[model samples]
Target: MTSLLKQPVVDAINGQVVEEFTASLQYTAIALYFDSETLPQLSGFFHLQAQEEHMHAMKLLNYITEAGGQPIVPATKPVKNHFESVEEAVALALNQELKVTEQINSLVSVAVRENDYLTQQFLQWFVTEQLEEVSSMSDLLNIVRRAGKDLFRIEDWLVQNPHEAAAGGAA
Candidate 1:
């Protein structure tokens, strides 16, 4: 396999690292908003998402270093706007996950074009992660859509379906 640390591939990988960290920051902000608004279950869900994003960032950072590339320290941007409702929050989460999935695919395309097999291998994990993320977000959206205006019903739905939360960690 060609060394991915060389030139363009290194830059691409570093960019992905930054994006992963940014995703973590965004999800953490959503989590905090849920916590402040007294939605513990939603807060817990986003908190776990934030943790997962951080783990993804670290994984990419480590890969960059292992490939002899300098892992750039990521800068954090403020996440603005609190979600007005569960539906809005879940929709935002789904959109954000979709965005990340696109980013990962783009990166993988770059690696493939550059013939960087090692980078492709490294990105395989992220591809799987994005699949799980999109699926989870979609599932949440479906649940909230079904729950509609009944917040109590939504809470009950969550309580009855504990496996949904468990599946998030499975990714």
Candidate 2:
């Protein structure tokens, strides 16, 4: 039976699942690093982020199965386990968010080019999600830079700003 999703699109989405899982692993590693550094709040934040990324990967896997395509699970790269500072870790996160945004944009472009309205509509959510991801990371990086080596300031900011703790920052 023919599937609603194109082969290339399914491949792309499967690739995206791997990317999301990779992000999860990266966050987990960062969280572990924060825990080792005695930054409980940051560690917890990244742990939550890792869970969100894992959820996103499962969501994509579901989409593939629902669309009658086989999801290709790929091995992710090893995550960097050390950071010089919270600022550096946050910078790495921002960079990853930017890359994910680029990837989502490319997927949207492909969906449009292929006239795959269903995929296009589905990817719209990701487009907005990416915007929020980028914005939140930018905000975090700015705060990290302002805090300098005072990691407590970041924890304090988190304590004071509960809204910033919103997972994935849905904007």
Candidate number of the best lDDT:
2
Kindly report which residue stretches of model 1 are placed more than 4 angstroms away from their true locations once superposed.
1-4, 168-171
CA lDDT of 78 in candidate 2? 75
Q: Write down the TM-score for model 2.
A: 0.94
Instruction: Kindly provide the TM-score of model 1 when superposed on the true structure, using C-alpha atoms.
Output: 0.90
For model 1, give the 10-residue run with minimal summed lDDT: 162-171
Clashing pairs in 2: none
Kindly state the number of residue pairs that clash in model 1.
0
After superposition, the stretches of candidate 2 with alpha carbons farther than 4 Å from their true spots are 169-171
Error of 1 at 76 (Å): 2.9
Tens digit of lDDT per residue, candidate 1, span 1-171? Answer: 444466687787778778778878888888888788777777777888888888888888888777777788778655655777878878888888898889889999988888888889879988887887898789878988997876666566667766665554645
Clashing residue pairs in all predictions, respectively, total 0, 0
